[model samples]
Target: MLTRLTPTPPARAPVLPTMGLMLVLPITASGGSLGELKGMSLEELADLQVSIVSKRPERLADSAAAVYVLTEEDIRRSGYTSIPALLRLVPGFSVARMDSAEWAITARGFNGRFANKLLVMIDGRSVYTPLFSGVFWESFDTLLEDIERIEVIRGPGASSWGANAVNGVVNVITKHAGRTEGTLVSGYAGDRERGLAGRQGGAIGETGYLRLYAKHEDRLPQKGLADGSDKDDLSGDRVGFRGDWDLTPADNLSLWGDLFSVDSHDPWIDGSDLMLQWEHARDSGAGDTLRISHDRFEMETATSTDDASIREDLDTFEVEYRHRFAPVRRHDLNLGLGYRWYRSLIEGSEVRAADPAERSFELFSAFVQDEIALVPDRWYLTLGTKLEHNDFTGFEIQPSLRARWNPRPDSTLWAAISRAARTPSRGEYDLVGVSTVVAASPDTQWMPLIARFTGEDRMNSERLIAYELGYRWRPAPVLGIDLALFHNDYDQLRTLEYSDLRLELDPSPRWILSVTPDNLLKGRTYGLDLVVDWRPGASWRLQAWYSLMGMDLNPVSGSTDPEGVALAGRYPRQQAGLRVGVDPRHDLELDLYLRFVDQLPDFDVDAYGELDARLAWRLDPRLTLALVGRNLLSPSHLEYGVETLGSTPHEIAREILLRVEFTY
Candidate 1:
């Protein structure tokens, strides 16, 4: 299962000769068709509201952050069955597939399977693992049709979300039980994926509603380097229930839970979670909320040769309370308190091992934020801070300041400065052993060389200071634009160093190289993101975005590592996407998307372009059928590699899927 980890030279970039013309033609063709289509107006889309910025609902155009919202209509039209694939529409996010079930997703930069800088949550429950500070996307099997929207914030969110929210935050919100009041049956089959789902919902009482759903999916393996070989396949099942009750005129109660199991070629995973929440509101823009949740996840993985196997089990419990009110004539305030407990166990026969097989930790946090209006309706400022205490990092403080100005009725300008941190994980503090083994010389008689990685107890948290500026402009009822720029400075980054080398002959003659982690790296990054949305006529909508990024890294005065410098350029420098939505008739809809990703020189990944299309026909108000084609421009291509897990990266091939939906 292991493969050599080495830096390869960059290959020639892929060519798409007509890509530029293809993008331009859509905008030009829409100029004369604006009044002919019957669809949502641009003004309605511009007024979409999001809640991730300050934990309070606000218009997306007025937020003081780089934010994007994927609405329910956008999700249905795009025909994406997974969250990771849906995120590709965001302007600054980096989404890549590693295998049949695993994905690497991040915002801005620092993209990897174990990307520790991003925080993800479903509703109010955190999904990031405490073991590695990353998410296992395969375990998130919620029904896509039940999702209401996804909010993406591409900047430091620690001031509100606490630690490990350095680069970004993603919040996936689902619809209320009351919104779905009937029976729904959905199924889809394709060259690569097949799944079936059913849901039943009804009124529980005069003021209560409940819904229950179950789903199962089987995914075919990915294409390998050689012909006819396939990577690991995946299958999984999930069941969930949700309930909502209006306890009184001003009080509400909500309960939800999910249970799931996944079986794959190399791993088996199972998990369950439950959540309860209550809220009380007053007419004067004041409210109090309480939430409590628990989650448990277990995984078992082994190699094909059966020489090594690993098992992991994790459980987490969390409680939170918050209140919001207007404290003064022109000022609003919000405060919250949270507590979490985590327990984990690991057992395995592998190259790396943890010293303490079972361990537990606790986290306590509190935060406060205030928004003040400088002018009646034109200018505003917000300030917030969070204090947290945890086992890995004793105590840490995060703060942010933001300002927004509305010079015109349809435009907004905003800026922000923030501080965030990435706390140490179990693997960074307790792991030790031979990470890899390789031949020391061409001759087999020579002793094999081993790279031994050892953890350090004195590790410090990685920190970042970020500055951001953004603007949103709506020139007419048919078009809108958004722009964002950011600069980040990093400190106390992690790097590996060789401490010792020796020959061991007790078991067998071999060379052991001792490697240790240190806080000896410093770096800076800057990037820009731009998005445009236009509706030429009532029948067509066009959306496009472009992003640019650059990074610089160096070792401290007393440290030196050439490899660390090369790793800094592991992300793409440029990326762009174009999407067109059209309705030729009242019952027919079509969507086309094109994307281009720049080369990753350090990872030996070449630049490439992708095309996806979808068409749907509404036979009646209660039934619909759709067809989707992905990666239509090429037969196969590679998106990423997983060197740390010693797994070979596979190729993504063209695929087609047909779906049928019925509701009553």
Candidate 2:
């Protein structure tokens, strides 16, 4: 186990929306009603704190490119029992279950076990692993209620966020202590699932507030648990907490820390892990803010047949400051600086020991952005650039330009061009070793020495240049639609090829694993996203979204299926979802949701459709009854494939779950 903490200082206040006049309407048998008040104003809605593509806080109506926001209300209404489930509603994102303990999630394309292009953060703390430069979604469990909102930026964000933000960025922001200023507890049990969560927050004094939460859950086995399957153990439990405080009127401080652990007894392996993080922020006045954070994660796993155990540890520290200035009434200037430290250590079996050689590095970055209002409320232009220095790549620069035109109060068009990068992961370099195998025929011993190159010692990072355009329209007071299109050109893509090597066994085994990261892949991706929200009547609300994506990798000699490769085109080409709700005046609320994902290639597994539905009835403002169903159309489904020592590959299985929740 590993742990550490750094001192810091913090921050939230809310902007309330004015209430519209309520209408006394007629009711229908379907529990729906007519003549409802309109929705919140764009200003009040955009004030919810968003950092989708840029660090600056701009109204959603004024942003350029594609962005989707999942609010707390959205989470509560969806009735999802987990974070992965909630992500299914995000546009341009691919979320699929690989197994009971694994998930494949990414933006745009290249969705896989090591989806190295996208970046994810929890309350500003990056959760991506330095070992693989990918997120271990299984290890990132948290109380959904603690999350304030999730901002999904569906394009390159490397200009300000640094490397690994190649395709898009997901910023998961949590609620402030002041908002959760009360005691709440929730529990659920159904089918093969059971969970409990509790939270408490309130004003500590006239100027300070704090919030704390803890949660635990036992995951159910896959659909075929009775068959003694080797797919996944799937069973697990986790717990964690978060807190914040307001230090002064001009300066604020906050502290958040959590511990997570999971145990599995199936799939021939058992595993457990823990993670903790702390963050602080300060206001420097003059439209300036500063933030700092420290996070750590540790895990240990063992093979069922072998007593050997693999242990890995990761630690990261980050500091950033943002300054804002007004060049004119409608013009703005912004500058910022950030620093991050990433460290990792791995120990275990010989193969594991040779996997990731322990290492640590530092990153420093600075950025400047200007948002010039071409017109008081109808037009804007923005230009930004980020300069970064890292241990592997001494210096790198990323820049972007964007513009937005709002012809009417409810309609807008936007476009942008940006550059992003994906730095090398731990597995790409440092590891070196050999293995010995005994031949049964002649009792001969064969030892093979395999050396991994420290490519970063003299290598360049992967780069991407992207273009995007989008439109938003609210044709009527009760309806709105948003659409976006994008294109990306890649260079210096990390690629690997096998080297010819000879091996001898009783049967004369000749095949060898050849792998390396080369700047030999070129690819392009394009996509369109549309989301529509309508409130046809006072009691009825409907939401729908559709996505179409295309991805192709440049053909290389001797590679017959380069474009159809697992990571390149494994994401669904089409995805759509719908949500409907009816709230009657009698404190009774009913909501339903549906989702569809197109097929994709995965090793030996065939693509399949995933269906999920939810039903919730609010008993009162503080309590609710909900029935949730995941993959209700089937007991289990195969979404991904895994290769072992033999030629026959196995696929990971899906599961069904039902849960109930209550809050007070």
Clashes of each: 5, 6
lDDT of 1 by residue, 330-385 (tens): 88898999999999887765564667878899999999999999996799999999
RMSD per candidate (Å) reads 10.4, 8.3
Model 2 lDDT, residue 176, Cα: 65
- Scored against the true structure, residue 199 in model 1 reaches a CA lDDT of 84
Kindly provide the TM-score of model 2 when superposed on the true structure, using C-alpha atoms. 0.83
Pairs of residues clashing in candidate 1: 33-537, 34-536, 34-537, 37-538, 37-539
Give the Cα error of residue 69 in candidate 1, in Å.
0.1
Q: In candidate 2, which residue pairs clash?
A: 9-281, 10-252, 10-253, 10-281, 495-518, 496-516
Quote the positional error of residue 474 for candidate 1 in Å: 0.3
TM-score of each: 0.92, 0.83
lDDT for 146 (candidate 1): 83
Kindly give the stretch of ten consecutive residues in candidate 2 with the minimal lDDT sum.
21-30
In candidate 2, position 205 carries an lDDT of 61
Model 2 residue runs over 4 Å out of place are 1-49, 223-228, 234-241, 264-285, 304-309, 327-330, 432-459, 503-514, 555-566, 602-607, 643-661
Instruction: For model 1, state the Cα shift of residue 135 in Å.
Output: 0.8
519: Cα error in model 2, Å = 2.5
